[model samples]
Target: MKTLYTLGLALVLTPLPGLVQAQASAEPEIASYSIDTTLKISTDRKTRGVSDTHGEPGLELTVEAAHESGLIAQLQLGSVSRVNYPEGNNLNAMLALGWRGGNPEGWHYGLGAAREWFPGARVDEAPAGFDASFTPTGWVNTRFHTSYLVAELGWSYLTARYLYVVSRDFRGANTATVCGNYLLVKLPSGDLGPALDCYGSAMQHSRGTQLLDLDLSYPLNGQTKLVAHLGWQRVRNFRGLDTMDYRLGLEHQRWGLVWGAELAGASVRNRDLFIAIDTDGTMRQMEKPKLILTVAKKF
Candidate 1:
């Protein structure tokens, strides 16, 4: 009887070691991150001077390099047009590279930059928050990120206008100044453009504005999380402009499947100079702030 009992105990303990080894081999021991989609919208109000206002949809397709590694990147496509800039729209692209490490490797940190190009605008001088430059738009961006903090800096440049290749507006306005427009660029002669300047333009033709973005994230469980971000931007132009932007998100996850909802906002207005690009025809503006939802899966 004693010999039989000893044999049974040996068999059970031997199987336990094999089970532990299999479990360790089944888990990933490298670095990686996930790719997500971002949808954002914004709106304006009555403080600066506007009779009417509206909103629109903007979409962004984002990517991640590795899961265990903190390195990442992103791409985006958006449309914005209203009064004097209607037929006008924009395409913006950006990238980010960073590191992830620390206690439990939950904290991520790194730095990188981005460049954006904007074309097809009805107006020129009066600059919006996200639009690149007028007639051949581009900017150089710098970014810093950590577990709970983010910082960014940008410097923009103007490329030669390739449109029509006949207009002189492109010829007069092709310099890289943080304040004031290129040259022929002019703002809408109404409350819309003026009010925007007061609230957010930093004056007009703002070149390299300063931006600081802060974020905090909380994990509810292994597959669910929440995040909130607050941002501030300042630009130098004919006058100084300031902006406040906020975003909150809730996300659910289940291995390769993810979905989320977000609310974002911005307060912007202006009162400054004007630069018109395709005038005498039709002009429009593209700006909005609406709720957004999205879902995605990985293979």
Candidate 2:
């Protein structure tokens, strides 16, 4: 249930050394603070190799403010798929507060706290026909959300990040739905089998889920760069829900716009854990492999 959003890669990375830096000895006035806003459109909105838009296009707007002392605050808003948020969700929103420092040529670090909100979204039942014999008694009856703390460390073109979930559950993932789905397939004969007690507690929470990732951006030329990322997600108390995700891509920047294309996919351990059902009765796998294309403008 990792719901991290796709961040614009080209716009966020530091350009090739000396290619975009001002002369070291030149005395240029420095602003104490600045604000940046970016609007992006993409073929799909991916979070850790999973499509949040259910293989559809996505639109996003992000605003960030930073001070000379390294304090930063950011807000992100983006389109989401109804398949993944059936109850109702116009957009996904995230707010983060953090600090980043150190020379671009040397070591750098960032620490922050972020929370993702899916307004009006809820998962109260299994998809129709998914498990008619199963009761939805144990489902969490509230809006979905994810809260986590992030820490990052980087040197030049390489960075590493770790996210630790602090909420009662990671997104909407819980043992109740997982176990219920398990019984659906395991007991196709319609027999209760080993009884409810054999399935363990149905009320377990996924509070300590974690994500660790490494990102690389190497300049292929002044206007183009090679980008890659690898990430692993571990769901605490749910070993079967773990996954590994990957991305490899190229990005180019010109004419005040950034363009990118990436091959992204994931190795999902449990297919039922991340399935989505559309309004048309379509069942979708959110972790499929696909090429993602994007264009973004920043001001």
Candidate 3:
């Protein structure tokens, strides 16, 4: 893969011992990582069989920072359902090579990929190959990397009636074949304000469309700082159980922390992927898309 080749080349191109010694003599190498803790406070959380007391709160923690090698490892701990691990309470990690010198340094653009697991990060499923003796077998992986071309983008704003949000979810299941959209939006952050699609509180992916979140945030300091949350959320259509997608975060001095709780919402007992044609000539869907609780630390 191109990504693999590029990473290999970057690592190999590092200057040799003598060259490194010269740079080190000029400036000692200094590296550091950060860990942020977040807490969640929720409202009534219930739908089908899953339910958190109306006032039940949740939590999660995420630690992600830059590396000297243009490589970054980001880890998130919370509750969400995955294909391989359906049980609640899981953690996830995504390590990638970042493009730090670009027009925007704070904007992380790089290579590499990620995997998911429960209680722990989801595992990287083995590429479809074979069993002992070359026999072929494996479950049809339905999330994350097993899913390529699965790019996502979303936007949300608080309004009087509801927390408005719209999103498009794409996945490249078979390298050659890509699956389409899953859209959703809840009314007023449902319960948890805004978490993320393919990222946080994923149990919210019941339908895959235009949905909203229950968002609440407040300033911890005057400027460039705050603590917020996208509580628990509803999956719009069938109204499955919602998770208390809560988080506590702070942003200041161009750096901060984001972490908290993530509970899983139950899947729709009865449902289907709703589809449509967008005004942009591309295929679109009236699906129930997922939401995200975002906290950025700038440097």
- Compare the candidates by lDDT and give the number of the best one: 2
Position 256, candidate 3: lDDT: 48
Q: Whole-model lDDT for model 3 versus the true structure?
A: 0.31
Clashes of 2: 0
TM per prediction: 0.46, 0.79, 0.31
Clash pairs, candidate 2, are none
lDDT of 3 by residue, 10-58 (tens): 2233468667422222223345443333433223222221322212222
State the lDDT of candidate 2 residue by residue for 86-196, as single tens digits.
Answer: 566668999999999997677999999999999888767542212335444443454468899999999999999999999987877665555544454445456555324
Decreasing lDDT order of the candidates: 2, 1, 3
Candidate number with greatest TM-score: 2
Q: Can you rank all candidates by TM-score, best first?
A: 2, 1, 3
**Higher-scoring candidate on TM-score, 2 or 3:** 2
